[model samples]
Target chain A: MLLTALFVIVCVALGAGVGIYTSRDYTASNAVKPAVEGFLWPNPRIIQPFSVVDQHGNPFGLENLTGQWSFMFFGFTHCPDICPITLSLLSQVQKKLAEQDTADKVQIIFVSVDPKRDTPEQVADYVSYFSKNLIGLTGTEEQIAGLARQIGVVYIVNDETAPGDYSVDHSASVFLISPAGQWLGLFSAPHEVDDIINRFNTISEYIKKQE
Target chain B: MRYSSGFLFFILIAVQSVFAQNSIEITDVWINEAPPTVKILAGYFTINNHSDDPVDLVTAHSPSFQKIEFHLTETQDGVARMQKLETISIPAQSDFSFSPGEYHLMLFNPVKTTKAGEMISLQLTFSNGTNIDVEAEVKRSELPPHHHHH
Candidate 1:
């Protein structure tokens, strides 16, 4: 994965260099993926079909993110620490993008791995608590599993001997979808908000230039 | 008279066994590591099993909270993961400490009255149907909800 990630870095760097030359936007410097020493981007996985409803109580399919780069995350609203932290990191990515003043693009989506409990309203409340732009999604158990499987995320709910009294085991990686809604790549766990912001900033420019 | 010494030895063994069977001792208990508003907590302490057999801890009941379960906090790929444990194996004559970011007990949805420095009575049920009640002291620091694995 290290060599593959380095190759990705080279691709992103080359794209950034080209974008800088054409756009002449110095503020977009934030878009350049600043090399984070010791940080390795995990290989992107093929995403499976994910069925979920958006925060607005509307059914949102995977194709909904078409034409835009998305940072997709799987988590539950009830999660206290890690959930907030991940969302905050994604928000930082958005903030950095705005700081760079790059071409208008990017959306962050949060998919609720715990569906039976997280209603649309609950999703909205949870995401809104972090950032208004953050999208919280929920769906039935089967739909959620399909999406999780596609993203290489596995979440298991162990028995606590009672309903609603269980814990879920899930993958920790954040999914990154391309403008065409294809699962492009993913950001692994232990990611810092600034690191994500910087990397996405770099990727955003590449995405815009490809168009 | 010859039977008297044998009787004494058996009595001594019985007395020793009383303290040796599923003896659970607890110290340094607290719940304030994160915050009560967060609705989750991890309690830690040492349990020294003095019995001669394995004790399978299955269930935990608490009067201070709505529900209590055995849980473990593990960080996979730096993502904090929390899960409820179905059974914990406590070997005889050894100690098991339930601490943060490791083996722990998850106490959820405490009532408004439950506060720091309060005593929480949690009963641990074993596979053999023996149960030991432990009194834990809620710490000054709020108990964190999720394990922050790095």
Candidate 2:
């Protein structure tokens, strides 16, 4: 009877060791897996304190970006082709993430380059047409430029002889900001909903593992 | 079924030509509806030249809009910019598609608020003294309403 009991204890110990070893292997494999297809910086870029206003005329700055991951795109409301299209696609991304039950922690911010024309009320109306989850922001040229420069978003207002007959040439890239208010990476133009969601999930998992 | 549909499309084109005397025929006309706060919108369509000679589209007129311009959105070094074109030439038996993110008609200052699902009228004038009137739907940016490509 004692011999049988010893054999049973040995089997149990061996099984437990194997289980632990497999788990260690899994962790090591996951750590080496790539997060997403973004141009991830070697170090997270820190954002400075630049004041802007939200669609509701509330203060929005670097502090507001704390505690949540953000995807920000720089465009104006009057941009007929790219701005509305990008915002609409981001809305689809938000909806898909919500359906997957992962969008509660993510935010999409639309920062307008033409603060002279895009008032808070106008921005509010424009964003509400797409999705309530989107946050619209605009500010004075200097303040907006400060934030734009930090993220490498460029915009130049064209000169037109007729009033309201010009366009603003701006960067068409979507930037990813970490939950700790650091610029994480950037996704280039022609963003797809499925690709964005998968990349976001992968990045989130990777960030959690790193933490 | 495919042959029958193709025949029907040809018949439809014949009928359109009978009415408009087609020097330049436009199909798949659509306009991207602007947000409530925006005053500018863009129109997309395909222009087909049915004549034996080339045709130059000189101007676009829309009574519903204050001004119209032929604009193309081009990206250079990741910067999206708009370039206004003076005219677009359609060669004989050739087609030019004014699609989104490419060549489009920029309609500014809408006389009436244009929402999705509404139709607007546009008149296109050619350098050869030909004009074609077309009606297009204002579509949401996400949903491309029509994709009838040949």
| Collision pairs in model 2 | none
Chain B, model 1, TM-score against the native? 0.74
Worst 10 residues of 2 chain A by lDDT: A33-42
Best TM-score goes to which candidate?
2
User: With candidate 1 superimposed using the best TM-score fit, by how many Å does residue B130's alpha carbon deviate from the native?
Assistant: 25
> Model 2: DockQ against the native?
0.48
User: Please, what are the lDDT tens digits per residue for candidate 1 over residues A44-103?
Assistant: 343444567888888887677777778888877655435555676677777677777666
Reference-based lDDT, residue B115, model 2? 91
The residue-by-residue lDDT of candidate 2 on A108-195, one tens digit each, is: 9999999999899999999998888899999888888999999989899989748666689998888889887788868876666677
On DockQ, the candidate that comes out on top is 2
Model 1 residue runs over 4 Å out of place are A1-51, B1-71, B77-107, B112-150
By lDDT, the best candidate is 2
Task: Report the CAPRI category for model 1.
Answer: incorrect
